[model samples]
Target: MIHSVANTDWQLASTAPLLRRGLCSLAQPLVSQTQRASRFVFAEPTIQLIVSGQLDLSTVHHHITMPASDALLFIQPHTCADIGNFRSIFLSISHSVVETLPRGFANTQTTQSISKSDSPFSTLALDADLSSALQYVISAIEDSQMSEARLRLRLQDLLMALAEKGNTFHNGNPETTTAKLRAMISEEPSKHWTAQSAGKALAMSPATLRRRLAEENTRFEHLLVDIRMHHAMMLFQTTNWHLSRIAEACGYRSTVRFNERFQERFGAVV
Candidate 1:
């Protein structure tokens, strides 16, 4: 079941299998006017169903709008902003889901047939079939008695419907160490993460971690800051917490330093 918070915090119920794998449900009753705009970075392919209000997301060269009841597919991660008031369900499809598809379903031929635009985002029209399928998946997630095996079947059905509607989550790119670090750090940004500590957690030596991250063209320090900044951005969007509290939650003892880092990452004052 979805729990509504009084202070506008997006409290997630992690009882569902998908919740453990990145599926997020949010229902914000009141979003402060000052909090309407903030930067966002989607680390995985996500499909957002706007339950109420509207959302406007813009990149450097593109701007798209989604009104209530519309669905949006973020095919890849990019810098963007949120506008308008909205309660939405954001589902980040994990890589493993693609492997569960029918053997030939996620292949190159399937992706090639979906669409021509290789754009990073697309708006999906919720036709009768797709809408019904989405509802099924949502209901299954909300049902506390839902079995993991049954829920997986429901999710697979929903994905199949999405594919028929020209939105497929066939990601071929291998998950990099950079992505792994971001996911790990994002879970607990307030932790005093050092290269040595992170390396130990990741089953590698500090030198090995440095070498892997260097190969990915990123450093451990950079990943930590990026995760912290992104975590702060999400808090700004989903909660009514004061800036000082948000800063402290993101691992900064000093609000001024957190503000500076947020500005540097998003190129905007939050």
Candidate 2:
């Protein structure tokens, strides 16, 4: 099913759906709001693409929302929405495969999730190439019904996307403690991530990175949260996986805790 709404003066958003390998699914919908989305529960993981406009996901969970150029990957854990505008292409994936995502690569993002202050994640933004990937995923869903093999190949390509941070943010090898910190979040989006754990990976103490980011006007906790959100978004956008795996892959000791904290932060749930 394709759902979209827009005016003759503007390009309306739209989407489609497909089942692949009996293991995954693809869905796209261009929601222009005009109305509030009903509260519903999904039993599969999902990849959401924001083709244009904005989405106000005010009730799924903790402040969870994405706008133009932003996308979200949602695992099938029961979810309920208060209200939202469908301004993007939303894909519903499978929780089983989503759980297969290696912990080494969970939280991936093209644009950073910035906070109220001049934080780094806040500065990140989506570009054309990344947008192309979203389009490809949508197209695959539209035609995926024709062949399982084709859909599998396309899905592989989509998975690679999670590891890339985009040329726009490319700055050569991230070899220092900061880069190592990034790897922990992007490479192992989950696994009980903490300031101390991150420090240990970089062969330093938690106190060290905390001090380092502090010198640069940041904190270990803040950076850690950014990494979590980043990968969470990637998980929501790429694979049709489960919420349990998404939480653990991203380092939550408990899936329930993961959902609670995630909703608390993003203001939505999946």
Candidate 3:
């Protein structure tokens, strides 16, 4: 079954108070074989520390695999799927906090270069020192006596460690043509997107775009439909919009068609 972040059922812990204060919280969701592939969208910058197992996070423009000794910081409004059975800790930082961070905090030299594109996600290896510090933070989260102020201090320390390491923010290389195309379609799911229009936007010929996507085991139409369906599910859960409005926003002129597709994807009605 496909699970989205909007579905609160997947959340195993409660962090409402921490989230309301614009502070970070820790989540340890149990990932089983039955629900191995789960989707999530981070509205703010998030730092994920893998405590055990392997986790694969894939976005429209990037694919990141975090083993037991890796961590990541994601700073965009990108939708990703969490593939694999892994118990992990997530530290979600508010956008305001990220914006106020110093320029060098991201450790740019180790980051993968994406020409003319700005993506805020980076991968880093978990060295011994960093791992110890992360362990402390995790412990603090479980401590009943750990006040909000104290927790914030620990978070600051973690951030400092990430910045000082210098190699934790590396992205590796520019996004592939297929990844860029996927991102474009996801960003504007409401638009009447076609391979030709996407090609124009990416400054590539339609044939070239199609070929690149084929190499990635995906097609332009498939990507468009997937993006639209995902958006529709999000809206259905988060908003009280009518079915017709949802269908229109998903680039469908007919609500009937939208409902049919939605049922096909989720085995339910809107």
Query: TM-score: which candidate is best?
Result: 1
- The residue pairs found clashing in candidate 3 are 110-170, 111-170, 111-171, 112-171, 112-172
Model 1 clashing residue pairs (backbone): none
Tens digits of lDDT, candidate 1, 1-270 = 334322123233442223433333322233445344445667655677665556677666677777665455444543354545555566655555555777655556658855455566777776668666766766677666877677777778877887766677645336677877776786678888999999998899999999999998998988899888867766666667799988898899998888899888866676
Q: How far is each candidate from the true structure, as Cα RMSD in Å?
A: 5.1, 13.0, 11.1
Tens-digit lDDT string for candidate 3 (158-187) = 767876765232322236775576455655
Off by over 4 Å in 2: 1-16, 30-33, 70-77, 100-129, 144-146, 163-270
Question: Looking at candidate 3, what is the lDDT of residue 157?
Answer: 72
Local accuracy of candidate 2 as per-residue lDDT tens digits, 1-270: 223222112221232234453446444344432544344333233455555566555442344556655434332233344435544445544433444444545343433321122211111233455445555655665662546566555554554464455311112222445544654455455566777777777777878878887776767776676567645644554445688877776777677877876666566676
Candidates' C-alpha lDDT: 0.65, 0.49, 0.59
| TM-score on alpha carbons, each prediction | 0.75, 0.40, 0.47
Candidate 2: residue 262 lDDT (0-100): 68
Global lDDT of model 3: 0.59
